[model samples]
Target: MDDLPDDALGDVLRRLPPRWLAASRCVCKAWRRTIDERRLLRPDLLPLSFAGIFIQFDSHAFPEFFARPSPSSANTKLDFLP
Candidate 1:
């Protein structure tokens, strides 16, 4: 494994599941701290664009809106204003 380049190892690390990645960080001091910081920093990195479409309708298409999925979670809450 030492023969492989650091970039190769980093590439493999990025493809791993979050749990395994976190565990791998514990192998050494630098590895542990790097992975720990990455986990903590992820939420702070948000995309520049946040956009969605809203299909508005009158009396005819109103019923269909209630049947659609509600997009709510621990962090985000959305309610239909209709």
Candidate 2:
């Protein structure tokens, strides 16, 4: 497979689904470079976003909240308590 040109290798890899594409990345450095250089796999397709977290303690009445701070979250409030 190393003998294959990048264009040809990329063509073959492009048809694979996200799962296989990720596996191909681990095959070798050349294949990984080709995949990254041609953008065969999109970073946005992977789940890398951090939204928020909730933690509850045995002694607490409510769960503690920790969220990723963003402009849209500026007005966000924890009004779930009653």
Q: Which candidate ranks first by TM-score, i.e. highest?
A: 2
lDDT of 1 by residue, 1-82 (tens): 6575555666667777765776677688656555555553253442344444455576666433234445675445356555
Pick the lDDT winner.
2
- Candidate 1 to native Cα RMSD, angstroms: 11.4
lDDT of each: 0.57, 0.86
Candidate 2 lDDT (Cα, 0 to 1): 0.86
Q: What TM-score against the true fold does each predicted structure earn?
A: 0.37, 0.58
TM-score of 2: 0.58
lDDT by residue for model 2 (1-82), tens: 7588889998999999998898889888999899999999989776576679888876657888899667764755679768
